[model samples]
Target: MALDRRWPLALFRGAVPVALGLLLWVAVTGGEQERQQTLKGRRAADLTHERRHNELLMAALREAAETEDNVAHRPVPWRK
Candidate 1:
């Protein structure tokens, strides 16, 4: 008896669907991983900005207090 001629065609049909499914899964998970990385980067940048703002605010307050203290210590030149 001759060998069947349809085996290759059947195999190809089954494999194409499996291969497509795997590719779809990879694409979806890769997008999610990229999104998570972007969120992490944004959070780090926000924290850095907030820290810098606090440092500048503290410096300004210290300078203002020093100025006030100097003015109070100065003598009134018009009086004796």
Candidate 2:
């Protein structure tokens, strides 16, 4: 009867460390996953902004080129 009481106490002592270790492992990995996800989202947003900026630059260039072409076809009063 005394041995049976010791068995439960001994089991509880051994199980506590294992449970704590698992909880720590879960917390560490969960934080790492969240960090990685945040990095990925930031990278995606940066790429999207860059793409939009490039598109706007392209549109401005096209408009400038068209204006230049129009000017080239017109005669200037000071030029022959």
Candidate 3:
């Protein structure tokens, strides 16, 4: 009878700490997921901005090349 009464008390003592540890683990992991999501969003925005800048530079270079070609094809005033 004494052994049976002691077993329930022992079980309750062990269960309390285990339950508290699980709660703490859940809170930490939940915060980490939010941080990961925020970082991913920032990286995606940076990539989109870089792509836009690259396209603008390419268009400018093409316009410059066309201008150069037009100048090259014209005859010199001295030749005429």
Best by lDDT: 1
How would you encode candidate 1's per-residue C-alpha lDDT over 1-80 as one tens digit per residue?
A: 88688988999999999999999999889789789999999999999999999997787567767764554355666221
Q: All candidates' TM-scores? A: 0.44, 0.45, 0.45
The clash number for model 2 is 0
TM-score of 1: 0.44
lDDT of 3: 0.81
Per-residue lDDT tens digits for candidate 2, residues 12-65, read: 999999999999998888789789999999999999999999997787567767
Between candidates 1 and 2, name the one with more favorable TM-score.
2
Poorly placed runs, candidate 2 (over 4 Å): 1-30, 69-80
RMSD of each: 11.8, 10.5, 10.1
Task: Give the alpha-carbon lDDT of every model.
Answer: 0.82, 0.81, 0.81
lDDT of 3 by residue, 7-80 (tens): 88999999999999999999888789789999999999999999999997787567767764554455666131
